[model samples]
Target: MKKPIKDQKMVIFILLSNVFTAFLGIGLIVPVMPSFKDVMELSGSTMGYLVAVYAVSQLIISPFAGRWVDRFGRKKMIILGLLVFSLSELIFGLGTHVSILYLSRILGGISAAFIMPAVTAYVADITTKEDRPKAMGYVSAAISTGFIIGPGIGGFIADYGIRMPFFFAAIISFLAAISSSLILKESLSHEEREQLSSNTTNFFKDLKKSIQPIYLIAFIMVFVLAFGLSAYETVFSLFSDEKFGFTPKDIASIVTISSIVAVIIQILLFGKLIDKLGEKRMIQLCLIIASVLAFVSTVITGFIAVLIVTCFIFLAFDLLRPALTTFLSKTAGNQQGFVAGMNSTYTSLGNFFGPALGGILFDFNIHYPYLFAGIVLIIGLGLTILWKEKSNEVSL
Candidate 1:
C-alpha cells in the first residue's frame, strides 16, 4: 500500500524529467542547425524538408502509437521512446552526410510519436478533473525550462564544436532512459489495458472518428495553431541568421530570454487564468496575440525589436499549448490515449506543412514565412469564432 502511494508521488516527477530532456534535446539542435546547413551547403527547402520528414514519420506512426499506449501501457512506450530518442541524437551527432541526418530525424520522429501520447495519457490517468489544469501547467513548465536551458547550453558549447551539443543531448537522453526504466511505474493496470484494447480502432478509423461534429472544430483549431507556430518557429533561426547576421549565441540568447519570461508567466498565471477564463476564451485570446506578433516579427529590424516580438510570440505559444491539451483531455473521458494520439497526429500534420512551406517562402523572400504564418492564424481565428457562434446556437 505504501509502495503504491510512493510510486504515485515519484511518477509525475520522473515523467516531467523525461519531458524536459526530450525538449532539451530538441532545443539544443535549434541553435546549431543553421551552421550545419551552411556546412552541408543545404538549401532552405532542403532544411525545411529535414524538419518535415520528422513530422511525416510521426504522423504515420501516431495512430499506432496511440493504440500501443492503451494496449501496451504507458511506461513501456516511454522507456522505448527515450532509448530511440537517444539513438537518434547520437546518429545525428556522428553523421556527416545529409542522408544520415534524414535517417536520424526519422528515428527522432518515431521516438516522439511513441513518447508524447504515452506521457500525456499517463498524466491524464493520474489527475482528477479539478487538478488537471495545474498538472498541465507543470508539464508546460517542464518544457519551457528545457527550452530555457537547452539553447543556453548549446550556444555556449558550440564554441567547443557544433556537434558537441548533439552528443551532450544524446548522453542526457540515454541517462534519462535508464532513470525512467528504474524509477517509473506503469500508470494503467492489466485490467484497464484489456478494457482499452476492446475499444481500439485502426488509424483511418480513428481519423474518421475524430471528424465527428463533436471533435472537428477543436481538431481544426489544433491544426491551425500548430501550423502557424511551426511555420514561424522552424524558420526563425535561419531567418535571424540570414536577415540580421545573427550568430548561434545570439539566437540562443533571444530564445533563452523569451523562454524564461514565458515560464515565469506560465507558473504564475496559466492555471489560475485558465480556471477563470476557460480554455475556449484563452485560446481565442492567444490566437489574437500570436497572429499580431507574427506580423510584427516580419517588420522588426533590430535585435531588440526582434527580441520583443519573439518574446510575445513565445508567450502566446506557451499558453496556447497546454490550454488545447486541457480542452482535449476534458472532452476525451475514457479515450485519453486515443485523443492524445490524434492530437499529436494533427500537430504533426501542421508541422509537416508549416516548415515545408516556410522554407520555400524563406528561399523566395525571408519575410514571407512570417507573413504566411500570420495569414494562417487569422484564418484560424475566423473559424474559431464561427464555430463558437454555431455551438452557442445549438446550445440555445
Candidate 2:
C-alpha cells in the first residue's frame, strides 16, 4: 500500500512537471517580446495578432483534442504535446520571419490543446473525489510557478540574446518529453477508453449537445473569465513598456514577483479557502476583485503601485481558474476528458477574442485593454447568477 501510494505521488509529480515545462515555454517569450517586436519591425496590432493566433489554433484544436484524449488515452497525448511544445519553441527560437513566429504559435496552441485536457483528465483519473481539490491546487500551483520562473529567467537570459531563452525552453521541454515517455504511467485503462469513445461524438456535435440547461452557464463563465484575463495579460508587457518606459528586465521582474505571490497564496491557502467559500462563491468573489483591480490598473502610475496591484490581480485570476475547474469536475463523472476539453475550448475562445480585440484597443489607447477586460469581467460576474451546478446528465 505504501509503495503504491508513493508511486501515485511520483506519477503526479511527473504529470505536474509536464504542465510546468509547457507553461515555462510560454513565459520564456514574454520578457523578450518588446525586443522581438522591435527586431521584427512589428506594430502593436501585429503583436496582438501573434498572441491571439495561439489561442485561435487552440480553439480550433481543443474539440478534437478532447475527443482524442478520451479515445486515445492521456499518456500518449501528453507525450505528443510535450514534443510539439519543444518543436514550437525551437522554431520560434530559430525563426527570422514574422510568418515563422506565427507558425510557431499555431503549433504551440496545438500542444496546449493536447496537454491541458489530457493532464486535467489524468489527474481526475488518479485522485479520489475528496482529495481532488488539493490535487487540483497543486496542478494550478505548478502552472503558476512555471509562469513565475519563465519570465524571471527570460529577463536575465535576454542579456545573453533575446532568442536564447526560447532555445533554453525548447531544450527543457524536450528533456521533459523524454522523461515522461520513459516513466509516466497511463492512467486510463483500455476498457475506459473504449467506453469513452463509444459515447463521445465529434467536436461540433459534442459542443452543440453541451449547451443543455445544466453546465451551460458554468461553461460561459469559463469563457468570460478567460476572455477578460487574456485581454489583460496578452498586452501586459507591452502595456508596461509603453505606458511607463519599462524594459524587458523591469517587465519580467513585475510579472515574476506578482506570480510568485499568487503561487504562494495558492500553495498555502487554496484548498482551505475553497472548502470554506465553495467554488461558486470563491469564483464570484475573485471575479469582483479582478474586475475592480483591472480598472484600477489604468489609473495607477508608479512602479511600486503597479507591482502591488499586479500581485492582487494575479492572485484573483489564479484563484478563479482552479475554483472553476473544481466546480466543473465535481459533477463530471466518466466524462472527465470531455469536460476538461470543453473547458479548454471555451477558454480558448475567450483567449482568441480577448487578445485579438485587446490588441486593436491597445493600439488605440494603451489603457483600453485593461478597461475592456474590466468590462468583460463585470459581465461575467452578472452571468454567474445563472451558474447552478448539478449532476452531469447530458453526454458530450
The model with the greatest lDDT is: 2
Candidate 1 residue spans exceeding 4 A from truth: 1-7, 125-133, 140-153, 189-195, 275-277, 333-335, 389-396
CA lDDT of every candidate: 0.80, 0.81
Candidate 1 local lDDT, 1-396, one digit each (tens): 112223466777888888787656545666776899899898888888777788899888877888888899998999999899899889988999999999988888888788877877778778776665566657756855764467667877787889988788788888888988898778789999989889777778778878866667788888987788667767898999988999988988888888788878976898798988888888889999999988888778999998988888888888888887777766776665567667777888987898889988989998999998998888887877655422321110
Residue 110, model 2: lDDT of 90
Q: Report lDDT (Cα) of residue 395, candidate 2.
A: 45
**lDDT for model 2:** 0.81
Instruction: Give the distance in Å from residue 220's predicted Cα in candidate 1 to where it truly belongs.
Output: 1.7
* Model 1 residue 169 distance off true place after TM-score fit, in angstroms: 1.1
Clashes of 2: 0
* Model 2 C-alpha lDDT per residue in residues 65-152, reported as the tens digit of each score: 8789888999999999999998998999999999999999899889988887788878878887666666776776786577556777
